[model samples]
Target: MMPGRNLRKPAPPAAPAEREVAVECALQLRRIGDKWDLRQRILNFLAKLFFPET
Candidate 1:
């Protein structure tokens, strides 16, 4: 093996259940209507769903 090479396998991607939980959390944040920045929160949620890595 080359020096400094990572021998262990990479971690598995996030499961569907985990992703669903994240989405639900985002939706809940969006649903809190009393917050002053509700529109930005909703947009952030949408952005997370569509661009998770970024």
Candidate 2:
């Protein structure tokens, strides 16, 4: 599962300004997801090393 995946789809914006806002929001969410993914992977790797049986 990816972080911020729910932000992938938002209600359609009607106005031009709304569209811009939506785009910006999506970009920011994507960046957040990238950071989360890196951290999550690191944690998972550590967990696997500490608990190999799981």
Candidate 3:
């Protein structure tokens, strides 16, 4: 076994409040009525989902 290696820490779990906030944000996105607002949100989401973050 390699010394002082293979000891990376696990990713921290998301907090309950963070999950709630994320849910609230998704709900808000659906509630947006303006076409431009919806389009921008979808495009941004797609970019984030498909493209590597810079």
Candidate 4:
């Protein structure tokens, strides 16, 4: 392995339920005019959901 490279295994695929939730969130965000604030909020929410222990 190359030095400083991440050796951890790749993350598992997202569950169907998680995909559905992501799609719903995307649709909701699309309806809003401005997405500057919503973008970060969405990322934080998804990160929390996918990495609850972190």
Candidate 5:
């Protein structure tokens, strides 16, 4: 069986004064199935290996 993928919908940029509300909206998305469980260290290693910014 194939792995189940979670799709995240992108939200439009919020007004400059509504930063807290924008973050709350993103957290709500994580409570749904839009968040992944990958470890940060792994992602950091992969980024250093594949994306060395000169």
Candidate 6:
């Protein structure tokens, strides 16, 4: 091996490209909807099923 010489040189930097912008539409959702609590309840049920004693 050469003294203090790097085996692999660094790669060349990439050129910048034009980026696309997307327009998003928003909708108002209620906090008390049934879908909000669904994820937590599913996770709890899975944990209970997998680890009962814990």
Clashing pairs in 2: none
What's each prediction's TM-score? 0.38, 0.59, 0.38, 0.45, 0.31, 0.38
Q: Compared with the true structure, what per-residue lDDT tens digits does model 5 show for residues 1-54?
A: 357977778899878769988888888888664334346567788999999992
Question: What's the residue-level lDDT of 45 in candidate 2?
Answer: 100
> Tens digits of per-residue lDDT for model 1 on 1-54?
999887998889889999999999898877775474877888899999999999
lDDT of every model, 2 decimals: 0.87, 0.93, 0.85, 0.88, 0.74, 0.61
Winner by lDDT: 2
Model 6 off-target regions past 4 Å? 1-27, 31-33
RMSD of 4: 16.0
Cα lDDT tens digits, model 4, 1-54, are 898898899989999999999999988887673576688789999999999999
Residue range 1-54, candidate 2, lDDT tens digits: 788676567867589988899999999999999999999999999999999999
Ranking by lDDT: 2, 4, 1, 3, 5, 6
TM-score of 1: 0.38
lDDT of 3 by residue, 1-54 (tens): 698778778989889999899999988877775667879999998998899583
| Candidate 1: C-alpha lDDT | 0.87
RMSD per model, one decimal: 13.5, 12.2, 12.0, 16.0, 14.8, 10.4
* Model 5 bad stretches (over 4 Å): 1-17, 34-54
Superposition TM-score, candidate 6 onto the true structure? 0.38
